[model samples]
Target: MTVALMWEARAVAGRGGELLAWARARELPRVPLRRETFRAPQDRVLVITWWDAPYDADLPELPEPDPELVTRAVHRWRFEAVDGD
Candidate 1:
């Protein structure tokens, strides 16, 4: 099976650039099948990593940024591919 892990965080006020850079520079302990990063209008940074593992597998995920860098704790979710080509 394949798992997609999503990690999202909102930067503190105008520190969006720094937060985005932090996520880009940080490396995972293990490389995933694919990884992508994104940002939104609310200074929110989102990272999604596709892994070839079970849904409940212990996959590596992006950690929380420095407390001062974000408004709150990072949010994470895991999903299994249901239907796709």
Candidate 2:
């Protein structure tokens, strides 16, 4: 089985690039991670990370959180490839 974990967070001003670099560096070895950006008219920014990993299998733990760059907002999910396709 495969699962997709979606994370939505708000990034600090002038820090999104730094955060992205950090995330790309830390993403798991075999997992697939992708990001998308959205800009609000008021200048706020939203970043979403879509991470895919095998389901019902142990996943590598993530590193310690960075306190300065990202603030986690919502985490919602739907199961995929539930029977391992």
Candidate 3:
């Protein structure tokens, strides 16, 4: 089964672009099947990575960037594929 991981962060005011760039430059220790990035209002950045492992399998994840670049700590979520999707 496939699994997906979501990572998110909120940048400090007026630093959304910098935060996005930082995210784009990251190189995870374990590459994912697919990865995507998104931007939202309020300087938020979200990244989703799809992996071939099972939902409960141990996987390597990217660590948060410098604390000075963000307003709050990063957030993460995990989801398993449903109906073989």
Candidate 4:
């Protein structure tokens, strides 16, 4: 099975770049099959990591950024592929 973990965060008023850089510099204990990072208008950063594991398997995920860097706690979601192909 394959699972994708989504981590999203909204930086403080003017710390978007720093937050983005911080996210980019983080290293997971193990690398995933695929990973991607994205940014949005409201200084929001999103990182998705794909892994080959069961839905409930233990997987590496990005951690929360420094409290001073974000407006609130980070948001995370886990998803598994549902296609029948």
Candidate 5:
């Protein structure tokens, strides 16, 4: 079965640009990954990534950031596919 995964993360105060760049650079080796980012009115940023793969396999791991500089973010999701529609 094919699976879709969604993840959302918020960056610390002024690190959104840096984190987004890191995400972009890190995905260079993967064949099929989709990602998007948006900035809130308060200046917080959100990133979401989607990919197609088998359910049993692990999703691509994001690079860990410096512990002192950023807060560990949040991830949310739903998994679904059309019935061969």
Candidate 6:
């Protein structure tokens, strides 16, 4: 099975660009099958990592950035791909 890990964080007030850069520069624990980064309207940054592993496997994920840069705690989610190419 394939696991998709999603990480999201909203930067404080006007620090979106800095936060995004930080996220972009940060490295993941391991190289994923695929990775993607996104920016949202509310100064939100989202990173999605796809891994090839068992459904119940525990994978290393990116740690949250400095608290001062974000409005609140980072959000993370895991999903299993139902279909794929």
Candidate RMSDs in order: 0.8, 5.2, 1.0, 1.3, 3.4, 0.9
* Candidate 2: C-alpha lDDT: 0.49
What TM-score would candidate 3 get against the native? Answer: 0.93
- TM-score between candidate 6 and the true structure: 0.94
| Per-prediction TM-score to the true structure, in the order listed | 0.96, 0.48, 0.93, 0.95, 0.56, 0.94
Q: List the residue pairs that clash in candidate 2.
A: none
Estimate candidate 5's alpha-carbon lDDT, on a 0 to 1 scale: 0.56
Per-residue lDDT of 1-85 in model 4, one digit per residue for the tens?
A: 8899999999998788988999999999999999999988789999999898999998989998989999999999999988841
lDDT per residue, candidate 1, 1-85, as tens digits? 8889999999999999999999999999999989999999989999999998888999898888989999999999999988871
lDDT of each: 0.93, 0.49, 0.92, 0.92, 0.56, 0.90
> Model 5 misses residue 14 by how many Å?
2.0
The top-ranked prediction according to lDDT is: 1
List model 2 lDDT by residue over 1-85, tens digit each.
4555544444566676665555546656554555554554322344444446556545443343466665553334434554543
Better candidate by TM-score, 1 or 6:
1
Number of the candidate with higher TM-score, 2 or 5: 5
Taking the tens digit of each residue's C-alpha lDDT, what string does model 5 give over 42-83? 324455555676665666645555554357655556465567
Model 3 C-alpha lDDT per residue in residues 1-85, reported as the tens digit of each score: 8999999999999999999999988998988999999999999999999999978999777688799999999999999988766
For model 6, the local distance difference test gives 0.90
Candidate 6 residues 43-69, lDDT tens each?
999999999998779887878889899
Error in Å for residue 37 of model 6: 0.4
Q: Supply the TM-score for candidate 2.
A: 0.48
